[model samples]
Target: MRAAIPARIKLEITLSYLATGSSYRTLQRLFRVSRPAISKFVPEICDAIYETVKEYIKTYLMKPYSRVSLTKEQKVFNYRLYRARRIVENAFGILASRFRIFEKPMACLPETVDKIIKACCALHNWMRITSSNNYTPSGSLNEEDIDSGHIRQGSWRDEINKTLPSIGTVGSNHSSNLAREKKDRICRYFNGEGAVPWQE
Candidate 1:
């Protein structure tokens, strides 16, 4: 029987695939592993990586209200929320730019895709913490001019925009009473004590 592939080699193959979005055939040639073996082990490694790093993942779900609304306070609230959302989007853009896998949709099961996303996010966080200097060099992320409040597009935007299409939200239009109340309270805070001079 053929010798089993080393664990380290399998990890390197998985990371290479994630970072480049390479095809199985391409990876087989690059890693000298059979296509079938690469396909089988990639998902397994992703699941392992996600299991190891899932604790670092946190998500906040806040959907902005429609633009048709009036109220000055509501408009400000939306603006602030939009600004915060842009930061999250920029983070994704950075990841997509560096790890080309996200630039295109993965042809995997939903659960596998979920594992891949969590694994990539975990890797991104790890790199940011351990190698911030090289991982996120200057001009690689969106920046706002402190004086003018104008957003300066990051270098990642140019690459991500070329391939990543915008996707619309998929959910009901109606908000629950509790959700509405929470949103109102947050809005009040933003307009009141949490207000920043630059947010005007």
Candidate 2:
């Protein structure tokens, strides 16, 4: 639909789908590409991004955030990097699930896929700012759950405290009714509703 846009821009659109796990059907029409082409693109891009970002993440960011170091600066840096990864990965997972595209082969694109990955990260930062609050553990469930599915209860608040966005939300400037509705859907997920707006 938005032709005349630079190829770089199209890449970003494609990356958004990958990071958020959006379906080919959602992107095929938008990109004017066949489903098979999209299927081919995502995986090719995944390696490229990991190659480009992994070094930056491990050295400048992750190394500094280490808590095991005796130096206070090192500890502080390590902690920060640790928290940042959590925030970033959580957002990626959110995108993947919301878009429903995290399966094999689909995540293989190249520059286009990288663009979508960045866009998903950017969108996560955006929503972090706009949400009414950083997600709170409202129910009896543990507030902090590792990917292993182990839920922690005692220091949940402490875990939240160590989180990157605990002090402030990320996006406070965007205004779109569609975005709001999408957020509502996400909130429902957080609430453990297990229902989709499309069903309603």
Candidate 3:
């Protein structure tokens, strides 16, 4: 029954919920759906979205041609795309427990489903923007990971040498720089100086 929902919406909601840590019951309440239906819709949506876009995100992996062509101007876009996926992937645990939006089997006009999904996604993105400031590392490993080691940025040498790499892709090296820059920017923007190595 719940299987009738389109896969795109399911994926968007899954990723958004994961990013925001909102729950099925809460989602049910917000969307007016039953918890059972919420449960039914989430995973299938996630799978559908992954199946749809998995190939488009090859730059996030170690694939060779995925990284070589990126110029500095496009660095930030690639960084955000790569990091968004990483964050979404990492946030799965948070999504499963924190967010399960099954809000009372939402009664929506068929035309407005897109609006709901976009609204949710926008809200999720805003939360992510704010999350870094309020976010606390839950584990010692995460704490250590912050200072693991600097990845010296110069070439696609390591990326290419990896079992599979993103060497030839556009903005690959630039994306690396963007990551470092994002770390610094986030830390500085949030006044997390000294606490985050990126700030120093």
Best candidate per TM-score, number?
Answer: 1
Q: Looking at model 1, which ten-residue stretch has the lowest summed lDDT? A: 161-170
lDDT of 1 by residue, 1-200 (tens): 99999999999999998999988899999989999898888889998897887776676567676768657778788988998898887888878887888877788778778778888998887787778779888998889987788989888777764857767665866778888888889989988998888677
Model 2: per-residue Cα lDDT at residue 148: 59
Q: How many steric overlaps does candidate 1 have?
A: 0
lDDT of 1 at 197: 83
**Ten consecutive residues with minimal summed lDDT in candidate 3?**
135-144
Candidate 2 is scored at a TM of 0.35
Question: In model 2, which runs have C-alpha deviations exceeding 4 angstroms?
Answer: 1-60, 64-85, 131-200
* lDDT of each residue in 1-200, candidate 3, tens digit only: 54565556566556665445466677677666577776666655544544543443323332111457764334544444464455553443232223333222334444434444443444334444557443323330111144664433322222122232223745535446665666545434434332423422
lDDT of 2 by residue, 17-65 (tens): 6544567777777776667765665545544455544433322222222
Judging by lDDT against the true structure, name the best candidate. Answer: 1
* Candidate 3 CA-lDDT value: 0.44
The Cα error of candidate 1 at residue 164, in Å, is 1.4
Candidate 3 ranges beyond 4 A from true positions: 1-12, 56-200
How well does candidate 2 score on lDDT at residue 116? 49
